[model samples]
Target: MFGGTDDAVIGFSGTGGQSLRQQFVANYAAKTPYLGLLGLSRSPTTISLPDGYSRSFSSTLAGAWYQGAQGYPASLTFGGYDALRGNTDSVLTLPLGAEITRDIVVQITAIGISSVGDPATPVQNVAAFIDSVVPEMWLPQEVCKVFKDAFDLEWNDDLGLYLVSDSQHEELLSQNATVSLSLESQGSTVTIDLPYEAFYQPITYPLADILDGTVLHYFPLRIAANDTQYMLGSVFLQEAYLAVDYHRREFYLSQAQFPGNENEYRIVTVHPPGWSHGLSTGAIVGIAVGAFALVVIACGLLWWFKYRPRSKKRASRLSAKSTEQDRDVFGYYGREKDGGEETYEKRELDTAEPGMRGSIASRCELPSPPLPQYSPGSPERDWPKDRGSIDMVEMGDYLTARRVPVQSPVELSADSEHERRPPPVEIA
Candidate 1:
């Protein structure tokens, strides 16, 4: 009743990706050696006969009805309900052409019902036993499609062994126990999906995760559903890369999975001249360390200049005191003439020690004082002895070089970064 009536025309529509045969044949032809798919009957109407192999229901020929026409119904008008499977009568296969289109065509048949029951209106209900019968299921298609779509393999006539992707299977698909139609690229496989309840066969996912491969588009299925009676249902076939010798009617099958790139794997390569890779982390630390070293060196120089001068204080105390007195006595900082006639003249002080200058001036001066002259032998008559002062330049071998003038420590300036230098004193 869902498909309408058993005898009524049941129209179905669906879509799918490129047919496996077209894809397989195209790949094999790509090599320099030329080949393609073995063309079967372009369209199959009935499995009853191979185009012209039909004969009446011969006793020995009933096998051909199921095997030839029924089992191999690649193309037909409509499909029949497999009473056993309990699944809707929808069979699918690869469609012609490369561009993905849907609802191209499918197989269906005429069903029958009888309208022979009499209708009687009852005012009082009469006791009657009613027995309803459920349809029997011969559901081979359910078991066939559900398990067959997991993978595709082919025996290589040239290699004589089945080459399959064992690692990829054990990883993403097998562990998850999930299945979808996956198309292959060079080294990776991507899944295709669509919207709507009919397409929601296995599971559900967001629109973002489904836009991967050329396979499993919705347009073809939309086209497949345009029929009034016949509708090609969705098919489940992994990409099958096959090989065919076009000249020979018998085409060979191989794991076309390689071409579709279903179950693909990715391998990243990092090649030669990788020398700079290890240095990146060290380079960052090196910059930080270099900055710290500069700070330490600058701080050390500042400490030495500011504090080193304290060590030379004792040696030059008298010399420094004499210079200060000379400046004040003949200075202009606080002195001025009140009267119009000047009473004093200004003179410059020679930066020399009193010990040497006094000795030289006394040597040439006339001395007439003779009162109480003590004999040289008497210790009480001797003048107070003077020790000659040491010249700073000649005191020690270590101090021979001219020392850098001590500068004040560089603190954070008012502007944060600008360091100001103090003015040097005039030495004249």
Candidate 2:
């Protein structure tokens, strides 16, 4: 089937398998908050304008932002199409306009249609809290979709080759064209071709390079649509070179070339019309996995960065701990420690001069150390004269010594020959 007519059957797909989100869900994979959007690109960095931009649902995207124009500021200029159903690159960098990307959060202060009220004239600071909503995907709006028969779906713009379900009611459509839908059902192929493409270019700066988070803005639509009249997008707009600037309320666009070796990302594109992602499942999956991996890897690297310093600091503590102590109380010699060390009393010798009273007699020669005396016949009898330390009287010249010569005074005398032990004497 080619173009559809008013007679073409128009009904919602109520069949169980007909649910729109069914095949797109990842039943076997780990679930993510925005996994559905991952069908566009692997993650945030790879995501570009319009479509790709929307897929980034990271924390950096928090607060308000804006992307593709479902609702837009009235200040922008809408650029018409180059041709019907063809590619037209919006000159974003030339400052002629801004090509919107996804992942942009717009504070949607208003949503109105071309035929009616303007929402941007709120007369105050436009606020956010979802002032309006992007219409849901499922709706029987005035969209150019395939139909089974001529119903409300039939349009004068439709190419006339495709017939509706019933032959009774013929529908009007454009001539010499073909309309098509990949929708395969009822053993019939239906399609339509349209000669219409349009783009909007608003004067913008290069601020829209990245997008994410809640978007807040005042906007009026070029055409108003019901809750069901939402646009379907592919990943191209997101993965393409793009920018968004809500501070200035402007969008920037450009052709993002793939980085040869550097980490710079590549732009996404679409080969056919009405493709939300790429034509093949492989393309869709590749984009999704790539983006997802990039985010996960980035997050992992950040954690490693933060935790790495902590570990290094702890390791350095081991070196510092050793120096903090004078020595291990038990020692660290790798062998059994010997017996307790002999304790010595700290005796402070009076290096200070003792004055005249402290001086020893010149004849005493600092009092020659008395020798030990003993009877040779017995070992115990040989009394040892332990060394005596001197304690002097504060005002007296004589030093006090507690000592007894091991030998008798007679031993000092030349006549006394008996090996004798003298009683210990305390010389004061």
Candidate 3:
């Protein structure tokens, strides 16, 4: 069974006498927030075919979480990625971490906050893992303190969260700040900017043990005791696109784009390394040039056969008529008393149909509509207030029920001493 209602039975192989299906069937007792977890790892897996053979599942996986209230739906694609969801020009590919548990790790150089009329203020650097399963950013305590000051956040010791008060929420909305994270991997860097709306989250019962059963607004952040706990979670994925090629042991990160219209979405297949469409650049160009030449030749032949002969016949007829009228003209001129002095009448040429010119002129000279002005407190200015709630409940039950106990703060360390590897090849 998948996604609650969609069910299918297939041969799945795994170790420890437990197949993928068996694991999922056993997960009901765990009462996790997600109905199922789609495997995106590069490990070899196979699907049994009706023809008594099996085939490997795709090696590439790409996806972006739905930007709640922002009108972008979650998307997942196997073997390729949705090109329109990610900025292709800014893609940064890095080799997977040596440890399987920390596959998608990157060194976060800095986290900055930028508000209207204010310059960005960046905090210290840290190495963080990007994991969508987690619901909040687990940063060093000092970084969390910086965030608290920047956003006027208050820590709820009882709840273990940064809870926002009504006035503080309003202030943040009015300020309209953006959080930017500068990430580096394999010497390549990319900055992902998350608007205020991305962090405008709500906490509800079941997900958060709200005894009053009232929804609360909070920033998704946690203070990590050590480097192992540092994580950029699903909240960060709201504005970042991730593509992983398990086969090649590399992954890519790019700023996620949320187009206003569905028509703007596009998918681009991530072909395997050393793969080709069996055509070279020169071959493609040659084909295009040849096709254009053929079209031109066909047009020339069509004009010669269909219109040129008729044009010649019409010209001959006009010549004959002119020859026949020449004598009549001369005869008329000869009989004229004014020595055939020609008179010509000057008349203005109508460049357009009677009303077309007047309408076009009127339209061209008309004033443009005045731009709409909005006051600071107007509904238009307070757009985030009207944004839909981000369903924090979907983040998973483990967030509230199985959270790790807070440990004593440990001194933060420089991430530069970590091992570095060469950058991975670009995925097309």
Give per-model TM-scores.
0.18, 0.17, 0.52
**Model 1: residues with Cα > 4 Å off, grouped in runs:** 1-142, 145-281, 293-373, 376-428
Off by over 4 Å in 3: 1-35, 44-70, 116-125, 211-213, 279-428
lDDT of each: 0.28, 0.29, 0.67
Per-residue error for 188 in candidate 2, Å, reads 41
lDDT for each residue of candidate 3 in 91-189, tens digit (9 for 90 to 100): 889888887778898788777788634454455568789877677899999888877888888888888889888887888778878888888877888
lDDT per residue for candidate 2 within 62-126, as digits (tens), equals 11112222321111112221121112243232121232333332221222222122221211122
Residue 269 lDDT (model 3): 82
Q: Residue 43 of model 2: what lDDT?
A: 33
Best-matching candidate per lDDT = 3
Which model is ahead, 2 or 3, in terms of TM-score?
A: 3
Alpha-carbon shift of residue 330 in model 1 (angstroms)? 10
- Indicate the worst ten consecutive residues by lDDT in candidate 2: 191-200
